[model samples]
Target: MLVHVRSDGVNAKYNEELATECLVWINQVTGGSVNTAGDMDNFYEVLKDGTLLCQLVNSIQSGIVKKVNNSKMAFKCMENINAFLEAARQLGVPAQETFQTVDLWERQNLNSVVICLQSLGRKAGNYGKPSIGPKEAEKNERVFSEEKLKAGQTIIGLQMGSNKGANQSGINFGNTRHM
Candidate 1:
């Protein structure tokens, strides 16, 4: 796959073909085609993974979908009925429990953690841009002053710096007197 590394440090890409395919897939999945690309790539990933759990988690973290609160519960309730969490609960035990477990999991699975965090839908702080302008353009015009030299005045290389012409010949001209 041809990937263009962006100049900026952020790891984001704009793949033309993938986007088009995603749009088509979205139309096929949803009974009615949606207006935006938000759910398109997600639905595609769900097909690849054979489940919608991951996408659902992403939506929750992104704040696109909010979780309903349990009024009686002391702890903050999860907004969405995450299938992955349900599956884990159904299983005999959960591997992750303590803060250490969560920290270790985050370190190992950075991408998944990012998706989960985004599902929370918290408003992030703004890092504003600075007011800076472009530098002034340099003048290419050359300035030269005449100087007196002996009869054996020598001229070397072309005045204009052409890479091709310089390589072919050692020097353009030998000895010369002012015209």
Candidate 2:
């Protein structure tokens, strides 16, 4: 049987000596050495220095293993439950027999949780793609043509002698609007 202990009380604030004693106690119980930082050098030159770093690193490594084992157990349990459900479906089992094997309400909740986890993973995967900033809408203003005249596209109603379009002559200075 796997021992499941809540980590609410185990934290880093414990004294280094006490933590080392706790590490020894845990290793004695769990058959795993709490020595993850055997290769790291101490800040000081003393050979047995940085005991706190060793304890913390070992504790972290053990915690990581425990976490991985817990997840694997959970996945195995889910897989077993699903397999039992599939076998029940195949054998045309009664509802009373399968109801005790798996709770449908809990299974529905687990399904929603799986969907949420999948969405989170998808969002994480999409985070690496480049983001495009908002683009402004282009205004539809008129564009003037810059083409050569080609003998037919000149402005209409203009004569050759520069007399202001065939009406005025010889510079009359009174009517400013007409000028």
Q: For residues 1-179, what per-residue lDDT tens digits would candidate 2 score against the true structure?
A: 33232245432222334323333433443346555231212111111222222222234233311211112244544444444334333333334333322222122122222222122222222333221222323568975556654445665545544554665467768767843
Q: Model 1, 65-133: lDDT tens per residue? A: 234333323222222224334432332113342112221121222233223222221211111111111
Q: Which stretches of candidate 1 lie over 4 Å from their true place?
A: 1-11, 36-179
lDDT of 2 at 86: 40
Q: C-alpha displacement of 105 in model 1, angstroms?
A: 20
Tally clashes: model 2. 0
Q: On a 0 to 100 scale, what is the lDDT of residue 125 in model 2?
A: 21
Q: Give the Cα lDDT of each candidate.
A: 0.31, 0.31
Candidate of highest TM-score: 1
List CA RMSD, all candidates.
22.4, 26.6
In terms of lDDT, model 2 sits at 0.31
